[model samples]
Target chain A: MDILQALANGFEVALQPVNLLLVFVGCLVGTLIGVLPGIGPISGVALLVPLTFALKLTPESAIILLAGIYYGAMYGGSTTSILLNIPGETSSVVTTLDGNQMARQGRAGAALAISAWGSFIAGTLSVLALMLLGPLLAQWAIRFGPAEYFALMVFGFSTLSALAGKNMAKALLATLFGLLLSTVGQDPQSGMSRFTFGLLQLEDGMDFLVVAIGLFAVSEVLMILQDKAPPAVQATVGRVYLSLKEFTFSLLTILRSSILGFVIGVLPGAGASIASFVAYTVEKRLLGSRARFGQGDIRGVAAPESANNAAAGGAMIPLLTLGLPGSGTTAIMLGALVSLGVTPGPQMFQQHPNVVWGLIASMYVGNAMLLLLNLPLVGLFVRLLAVPSWFLIPAVLAVSFIGVYAVNNNPFDLLLMTVFGLVGYVMRRLDFPLAPVLLGLVLGYLMEVNLRRAMAISNGDVGFLFSSPIAIVLWVLAGLSLFAPTLLSRFVKRGALGDDEI
Target chain B: MSNPTHRTDRIVGVLLLLLSIAYGWTASRFEVGMLSDPVGPKPFPYLIAICTAVASLWLILRPDPDPQWPPVSFWLPLGLVLGSLVAYAYLLVPLGFIVVTTLEMALLAVLFGARWWQGLAAGLAFSLVVYFLFTAGLNVPLPAGKIWGLGR
Candidate 1:
């Protein structure tokens, strides 16, 4: 079926009373999680997966809810950054640069209003782009061989490791560790247990939900405990609506940043954080010395907010079309999809049109819901900041613990989650990027399956990896991604020092 | 400024190197199936082992300067939180979900510096609400207490 027909079907699924209620609930929960520190979209979605299973909703509805949370969190994330200067997630880090400044200047309402408007516009634009691009990419990807898929997976890993954090070595180590963890279950090819350590639970391998909760939720709780409590939020939020002049001034920046953010989001491993940073920098460059860019500039707030939301939408493109998750949150979403018995790939649109389109339709509904929720409810969310971390952190932990336990009705998973939580804590302390580890875990099985399949087909000839044109192109892209960071940094350094000095 | 750079890096590197060696050694013992393909399960683990070894060596050889550690005040609370989680895991199935969760939440709240009554109230309220929400509303089978039949 064509896009319009599929989307009409999707809206039918999305607008069903149950699905609509779920979308609303997802948005509400997502905003709450986003407004609250320590729990992000990853953990929020992870924590809810088992609950969705318990609810026994159809896969399409479940995904609609989860996807709602994913983008809704992006919208809610800016609230804390603007009001309290604490970014609820990595993507909101750039928002705090000018968002907090605006709060301090007592323009918190204006900043919040612009962020919501920018997010809505960018989110809508990106969803439209996804509607256009998703099918085309899926059409192209249907022709990929196992070798090409393997190369693409490699490229995903390399890009993630390269941009995951400041330390490439740490990121690489995390990726390797994740790959190792993925190898814990029975091998799909041989049915040989590689590292089950003789537990029956080990037979199924580590649940991604457990790992995600431990790594993201539990680790965050520990980190929060280690720090002092957050300071009082700035409460002088003047005028919840932006003036006509201010809105007009920021329209171009919002549009430009949205496009930039969408492109970055489509790239594997380059997520909202990077998009926001790049958008803010591009906006700064465009403005020059006309305004103090970082010092409470409304354009700075508008640009990053628009870009990050746009990027969230953009990140969905690869996931929906290629089944390759471009970011950590998308990785969790992939796990959710797999658990729901839906394998996302080029054939996903053909096989699961309702699910793919319903999710797309829900994004439209979700973005609208968020735009409404955020503007008027900004004050209510800011009030949540006063809810003590002591109480909030423990509540998150309790939810995580229960969520994991409910997955298999086993306490062992809770213990495993705790262990991973500790490991996540250590990794965080040592500055390892958590996202790469997650990416590795999510992609590891697929990578191995494709590699073994490719090898088997080629009669164990490793040369086949380099033989196909698509495979060769992907391999070259992977190589470039792996070294891109080093090359870019060197070039940046040289540029900073000027040609003669270099 | 007084401290040497990369103290944590050197320690982590050494630990990772040892882990990779152990992991590599363990991975070599997996039995290859009779009908297994030429590239078996061993290649993936071996690759990971090699990556870990190389990365750890790199970390050891060239550690990042000016690594920041959490302050002294952080350790006690961190330890408390960790210990409470472990305890919660052990106590969960036996003492039941609601009871253990309540205790664990209260303990964590106090550890994070909440007043006793405040922690107790928040923990009790939070645990009870979540328990009912999951068990009654969502149909998740959280364990009823063996000691007292509170959750069934």
Candidate 2:
């Protein structure tokens, strides 16, 4: 089917009242999660995956909900950066430079409005591009064999390991650790137990949900303790509507950043963080001295906000097309899809067109809903930041505990979660990138399976990894991905890229 | 709160190295009945172990100069929170979800400076609402407790 036809079918699925409600709820909850200081989109979605189960959603509806959260977060993540000078997620780190300044100048309303506008425009535009590009990529990716897949997995791993942390060694270690952990259950091929350590509880291996929530949610709570306290919210929402001049001023910026962000986000290693960071820097360099680039420049606010949102859309392309998640949120989404028995790849378009297209169609609807919610209700979300940390902590922790237990009803998993919480805390403190660990854990099985299949086909010849043209290209890309961080850091100061890889 | 020159990375490296060794040893001991694939499980595990070993060695040799360490004062409360979670994990089934969770949440909130009764009130309210939400709304049955039977 053509893109338009599939999207029409998708609209049929997405327009269901229950699905609409889920989309609305996901976007609202996602914005709230993003605006809240302690959790980002990854943790927000990871913490709520079980809730979707509780709702007993179909795979399509569940993905619609989760995808809403993923992109809705990009819109909300900027609010903190603009208002409080603290980024709710790494993607918004660059927003603090100009956004906070705009707020201080009592242009907070304008900045927030512009971001909502920029996000809505760029996000929807990127979705349109996704509609066009997704099929083309899927068509090309359909030819991948086991060797090609093995090489692609290597490429994915290298891209993440190289750019997911300041130190490639630490990131690589995190990946290896995750892979080792993944090997704990029975071997998929041989039924050999690799690392159960005599525990029947672990025979099925670690539930990615438990590890994810433990790493992102529980560890985030612990990290909050290190904060003396958040800076008081002093910015007032004067007016949310932007002036015509401001809109005219930022039009080109939004367009440029959106296009730039989408391209970077399509690259496996480059995530929304880089997209925003690079966007802001490029905007500044291009408009030097003509516009006040950093200090209260409305274009500054528009550039990164639009870029990050567009980047988020771009990041989903790889995950949907090649089953290679470029960012942490997409990785978690991939994990959720697999757990739901929906494998995302080129075949997904053909096999599960409703799920794919429904998710795509919902992105358009969700983006519109976010613009509706964030514009006038920006005051409400900003008010949420006033909630005392203590009150929020208990609520968050309670939700985390109940969410985990409700899914499995197993206390052993809770204990296992706490262990991962400690591990995640240490990783965060030491600045080890946590995304790779999750990605590695999620993809480890697929990687090993693909490798073994390829080897089996080639009769244990390691050279088979480089046999096919696609595989060879992927391996070469993987080789380059290993050095991406060092090379990229040379152009952009390492400081410009925040420590949070996701 | 910040360490300009920290040996913690080296400690982490050594730990990772030990883990690599242990993992390799364990992989070598795996007794497979039959190999479905030529590469089997051993090769993949070995490759991962070697990567871990190599990564750990590199980390030890070139540790970042400035790695932030946790604050000294935060350690006690951090430990307390983790301990409470572990306790909650073990106690949830025996004490039931409502009773155990209420206590756990209250204690956690109070440790961070919520008034004692305020914490209790919030905890009780939170737990009860969540219990109904899960059991009634979601149809996922949570444990009421083996000892007191507080919830169904």
Write down the C-alpha DockQ for each prediction: 0.73, 0.73
Per-residue lDDT of candidate 2, residues A1-502 (tens digit): 6778899999999999989999999999989887887887888888788887877789999999999998888889999899889887888999999999999999999999999999999999899999899989999999998899988988888877876767889888988888888888988888877788889888888888888888888888888867744845755778887999999989999999999999888876678888998888888879999989778999999999999999989988999989988877888899889878899999999999988899889999999999999998988888888877777887898888877786577998899889988999999889898888888888889899999988999899999888888888989889877875566677877676443232
CA lDDT scores, all candidates in order? 0.86, 0.86
Looking at candidate 1, what is the lDDT of residue A259? 98
lDDT of 2 at B25: 92
Looking at chain B only, the TM-scores across the models are 0.88, 0.90
- What shift in Å separates residue A181 of candidate 2 from its native position after superposition? 1.5
Worst 10 residues of 2 chain A by lDDT: A493-502
| Segments of candidate 2 deviating more than 4 angstroms | A231-234, A484-502, B1-6, B150-152
Native-referenced TM-scores of chain A, all candidate models: 0.96, 0.96
Which 10 residues in a row give candidate 1 chain A its minimum summed lDDT? A493-502
Superposed on the true interface residues, model 1 gives a C-alpha RMSD in angstroms of: 1.5
Task: For candidate 1, write residues A1-502 as lDDT tens digits.
Answer: 5889989998998899999999999999999988888887888988988888999988898888898888888889998899878898789999999999998888988999999999999999999999999999999999988889999888888877776777778888888888889999888988888787888888888888899899988998887777665765546566788999999999999999999999989988788988988898888878899867879999989999999999999999989888899888999888888988999999999999999999999899999999888888888887888877888888888888888998888888988898889999988887888877787898899989999999999999999989988888889988887776667767677344221211
Docking class of 2: medium
